[model samples]
Target: MVCDALDLDNEEAEEEMYKLTRSFVNPHRNFEIPTTNQVFKMETGKNDVSLFPGQIVTVQIMPEVIQVSKKAIPVHIPISSPIRIILHPMFHQMTYSKAVQYLKDKSNGSYVVKPTPKGFGYIAITYIVEKDKAGVSVGLRLEVEGCKYIYSDLGELIVQYVEPKARRAEDLMAHAKFKSSVENLNSLEMNPNHSSYGFCFDYEMP
Candidate 1:
């Protein structure tokens, strides 16, 4: 029987493989799983196996010997750049309240992108909508889908205001409208007096 051929006792192997695949797909993850490819040399005191693209192999995880070499391995996979709503010299790990406070006195249209405190691969874009006697700040939720960023109705409303035909968040990033807006916002001098002026936020799920 097929079940007889399988080594059911070694369940960690399957989990390790899944982790490896996840790490390959998203390099930003905290842990890494080694592959039998040239990019990762397996020093398991056995004959090394060469793997071609799209090839599959059963990996046996040796927890004791699973150590990556000090040599750097060049990853050929194309990873997307972090979504930066505004170009500012700030730390990418600030809280939501701090982010709001940073933009409290800024002019309308000023914005900041930060990782959502709720996590789960979601991000928040906080921007100033009204900067009159009473300032108004709006936070929009954005999700990372593979290499692209996407948002729902609220994001659509803002994107449509700049580009009526825009669909994906990448569209807004590439559009001249938002590019100009980012440049204008970046050009504005940051208020050094503000306590949270140098703090920002960015995060990736593992």
Candidate 2:
């Protein structure tokens, strides 16, 4: 029964059957990054890169270690398999190379395309948005394949720092200003002409 299903009698038939079966399953599963100190470490302390808006950065993949032998010798390997670039909630149905080119053209180079090395010779690239309000670099934050990590350029592990406590004062001031403005606006008598207009934020709406 096994031979009939796998077609052991004919090598050509077996190859065809394998391909047919593979079509049903996704070839590229999601890849995640390792973050433990025992598993990885950052290679550099330099954590800032000035990336402009609409700029696309293409990063090369680095080789990574998979396992350590009983003799305490680490085994390193180069990535050989293909990778898929994740865009939205779902993974794109294309290779990383094609996806990178497609995104570069689609966004007119408004995205950062930096591929980092995951352990075991698997590399995954992450997309970063460089906006005016979000330009603070806290190392390379990756959340691909439902995994997150902060790593150096060489793919070693690192820690991600939260926004400084100093920003709290500025945040409080901004909130106070917004509250004051709303309170002052609420005290104003509604202009009958302006209230009759189709303004979406009309405070005179009963």
Best by TM-score: 1
Write the residue-wise lDDT of candidate 1 on 105-187 in tens digits.
87555555556655435545555543212211223443333325445544453454323322233354455434234335454
Using alpha carbons, what is the TM-score of model 2?
A: 0.17
lDDT of 2 by residue, 1-206 (tens): 01112222233544554544343234462222322322321121221342322222212223454686667667798887565453443233444555455455432112233333333233343232211111122233433223543454322221121222224323543452332334454544365543332211223321
Worst 10 residues of 1 by lDDT: 197-206
- Per-residue lDDT for 138 in model 2? 29
Q: How far in Å is the alpha carbon of 8 misplaced in model 2?
A: 60
- Residue 65 deviation, candidate 2, in Å? 63
**Ten-residue segment with the worst summed lDDT in candidate 2?**
128-137
**Local distance difference test, candidate 2:** 0.33
